[model samples]
Target chain A: MMNQTKFEELCASFALGALDDNEKQELLRELEESRPEQLETLKSYMDTAEHLPAGVEQTDPPEHIRAAIFKEIGAAPATEQQQDEATPPRQIAPPAWIRAAAVFLAAVCLVLLYFTLNLNSERIELAETVEQQRFEILDLRDRVQVAERYLEIIGSRNTYLVSMDGLEPSPSGFGRVFYDPESRAAILQVANLPASPPDKDYQLWVIREGTPVSAGLFSLDVDDQKRYFVLEDFFEEDFEGVDAVAITLEPEGGVPQPTGDMFLLGSPS
Target chain B: MFILFALLKKLTGDAQEEAELLIAVAGKDQQALGRLYDLYKRLLFSLCVSILKDRHEAEELLQEIFVQVWQKAAAYNPEKGTAYTWLVSLTRNRAIDRIRSKSWKNQQITDSDPDNKILELIPTEGSNPLHVTVAKQRSTMIQQFLNKIPDEQRSVLTAAYFEGFSQSEIADQTGLPLGTVKSRMRQGLLKLKEMLSGKEDQI
Candidate 1:
C-alpha cells in the first residue's frame, strides 16, 4: 500500500482527471481501505477541481440551443417568452363555488386566483433576493477566514521567503516561495512568466546536490497575471538539504523531474 | 414535456433548490427537468463553447448532455457533490471527450491560441438571484483566487481542467516523468481545495 503522503498526492491527480491504469487501480484500492476522514479529504479535492471552472469566460448560448435540448429530451422547446411569466395553471382547482346563480361570485374567485398567482410569483422573487443576500454573507465569511489564515502563515517566525528571478525564456518572470517549516504552510506567488501551451505545464523543482526534485506543477493565470497559491500543510520534509528552487515548462500535468527549459530560478541568501 | 410554468408552481421554497430539482428530475418529472434547464443553460453553454471553441459543436454536445442528464439523473447523489458541481463536472468531461477525439482533430485546422490570455469573464444577466448568487460570487472568488496561485500550479490545473489532460498525457506531452506530473497535480489541487473548502456551499 502507498503511504498516506502518496495517497494524498494521488488524490490530486484523481481530482484533476483520468489516471494511468496502474495509478487508477492503486487509488481505487486506497479508497476502499481508507477511513472516512481520508475520504472527506479526497472529496474536498474533487470539489475544488470541479469548482475551478467558474473562472472561465461566460457566454450566452444561442436561443435554439434550448430548443435543441428540449427536443433531445423529447420535449417541446421552452421559449424564453414562455418562461418570462408563469404559465396559467394547467387546470385551476375545480371552481367549487360555481352554481347557475353564483356565476358572478365565481368570476370574483377567478380574479382572486389571478392576484394570488401574481403574489406567489412576487414571493418567489423575494425568496431569490434573500438567497442572494445569504450567499453574500457566506462569501464574506469565507474571504475573512482565508485572510486570517494567510496572515497567520505570513506572521509565523519560522516562515522564510525566497525569491526566484527570470531566466532566458522569461527574463521578466519572477516568483516567491514562502514556507514555514514548523506548520508546513507554504505559499507561492509569481508573475511575468510566459504562458504554457495547451498540452504543457510549468513544473517547480527543488534542487539539492545539483539534482532537481519535483516541487509541483502550475500554470500562468489566464485572466490576471499574478498568482498567489497556498497549501495548508505542503511540506513533506524540512528543506535542510535543499539548495535552490526553479520552474520549468513540462508536460501538461507535470513530470517526475525537470526536463524542460528553466524559466525561473532562485537560491536563498 | 417538462412545463416550465408548472414547475415554478411546484417550488418548495427551499433556499438552494438545485439538488431538489435534480431529484425531482430523477423521478422523470418533466417539470423539474425544465426548471433545471432554465437555471443552468447559459452557464453550461458558455463553458461548452469555451472548451470546444465552436458554438456548433458546443450546442450539439450540450443537447447530448441534457439527454444524458435525463437518462443518468438517478446516479447523481447530492451527498457526493452539489448539483452545480455535478452538472459542470459532467459538462466538462463530455466536452473534453469531444475535443480530444480523433474525429474532431480530423476536421479541425484551427487550434486554441497558446499565446492568448483568458480575459475576465462576466456572466450574462437574467439568471435568478437564487441560482445566480453562489455561481456569481464563486466566479468572482475564482478569478481572485486564480490571481493568487503560482503560474506553474495554474498551468497544470488548467491543462487538466480546460484541456482535459490526464497525468500521463501531461507527462507525455511535456517530456516530464510521471512522478513529477503527479507531484504538481497534487500540489496545485491541494491548495485549491484549501480555498474552496472554507465555505460550505449552502444552497
Candidate 2:
C-alpha cells in the first residue's frame, strides 16, 4: 500500500496524465480506496489542472472535417426530427422468426394453389397456370428477401436515415435515404411523387462536399406515386464527405451531372 | 473590463448549452454530437497540433477523439468536472498517447518541431459569435492565472501539461535538475488551484 505522502506527491502529475503506466495504475488503485476528504482534494487539483488547456486560442477545423467524420462513423448527419426523437440505441434488429414464418407461409400457399388449379382445369391450361404460379412465387420470394434486407439495414446501428423534402412545384412529395457507409448500401424511398412521363426518370444524387455524384436513375412502376429503390453498392468507394442528397428529374438514363430541376433536397442536420 | 464581464456571462450561458448537448449525445443524438464537435473542434485540434506538430496527424487524431466521444459520451460524469474539462482531458490524453508511441517517435522530425510551431488553428473569418466570446473569456482567465506564477514554474507546468513531458523530460528540455522540475510543477499547480478556487467562490 502506498502512503498518503506519496499519493499527494503524484496528484498533480496524475491530473496532467504524465505518470508512467505503473504509477498511474497505483494512483488509480489508491484513489479508489481514498477517504472522502482526500478524494475531494485530489479532485480539486484535477479540476484546476484541466483548465490549463483553455489558454490556447479556439481554432475551427476545416469545414470538410465534419463531413469526413460523419462518413467514417456510418451515421447520417442528424436531422431536426432525429434530434427531437433523441432515441437511445436507434438501431433495433427485427425479429428473425417473424420474417422466416412469413416466407414459409407464402411458399406453402403457392404450392397448394398449384395443385388445386391442376385439379380444376384442362391439362394444358393447368400446366401453363402452374408454371406462371411458380414464377410468381419465385418473384414474391425475391421481393420478400429484398424487403427483409431493407429492414435489416434500416434497423442497423450503422445506418443513417436522412429525410428529404420536396422542392417548389412538388410540395406534397417527400423521400428518405437510408445509407450505411460501412456496407456501402443505400435505399431511397419516395412518397407522393408526381408521376413521371415514360421518357423521364427520377435520378438520385449523393452530394459530397457540394459536388453531386449520380447514384442512379429510378422509375416508378405503373404510375404509382410511391416506390422503394435499393442499391446494393450505393457508393463504389467508401462514402466520404457526403454533405447532402438530392433527386432530380432526368432522361431515362441519368446524366453525368444533374441538368434538370431538383425535386427534393436534404442535408444531414 | 466591461467586455470581459460580458464575455464571462456568455461563457456561463454556453456552459448550459454544452450540458444539453452532452445529454443529447449520451442519448445517441448525432446532431448533438455535431453541435458538440462544432463547439470544441478548434480548441481540441489546436491542442493536438501543438503537441503532435503535424497538421495531418492532428486532424486525424481530432476525428478519433470525437469518434470516442460518440462511443463513450455516457462515461462522462458531470459531477466530476465541466464538459470543457472532460473534452480537454480527452484531447490531451489522446495526443500524449500518440506522442509517446514508438511509431510517432520514428515519424517525428519529418514533421515540424512542436516547440516552434505557432498555433494557427483559429479561423479569422466566419466564427460563431457566442463561441468566440466564451473562448475569449476562458483564454483571458487562464492567462491571468498563469501570469501569477513564477516564469520557471509556469514553464514546467506547460511542459508537463501541454507537451506531455514527464518530470525528467521537462528537466532535460529545460536543462534543470529533475528535483527542481518536479518541485516547480507541484508549486505551479498548487498556486493555480488556489487562484481558480478563489475565482469559483467569487462566481
Best by TM-score: 1
Candidate 1 runs further than 4 Å off:
A87-269, B1-16, B102-134, B197-203
Worst 10-residue lDDT window for candidate 1 chain A reads A84-93
Q: What docking grade does candidate 2 earn?
A: incorrect
TM-score of 2: 0.46
After aligning candidate 2 to the native by TM-score, how far in Å is the CA of A162 from where it should be? 99
Instruction: List, for all models, the DockQ compared with the true complex.
Output: 0.21, 0.18
Candidate 2 per-residue lDDT over residues A113-145, each given as its tens digit: 999787667777878999999999998988897
Chain B: TM-scores of all predictions:
0.66, 0.67
- What digit string (tens of lDDT, one per residue) describes model 1 on residues B88-194? 87788788878878443342212232111100011122222223222544566766676667877777777877787888888898888878877887888777656
TM-score of each: 0.50, 0.46
Candidate 1's TM-score on the B chain: 0.66
Task: Quote the lDDT for A72 in model 1.
Answer: 74
Per residue, candidate 1 scores C-alpha lDDT tens digits across A1-269 of 67877887777877776465567667766766767667666655665666666667666767777787777778877676565343334123345554444887788899999999999999999999999999999988877876676677778887877799999998888998887788887788789886678899888887887988887777874633777677656657777777898989998999887888998899865
Error of 1 at A137 (Å): 78
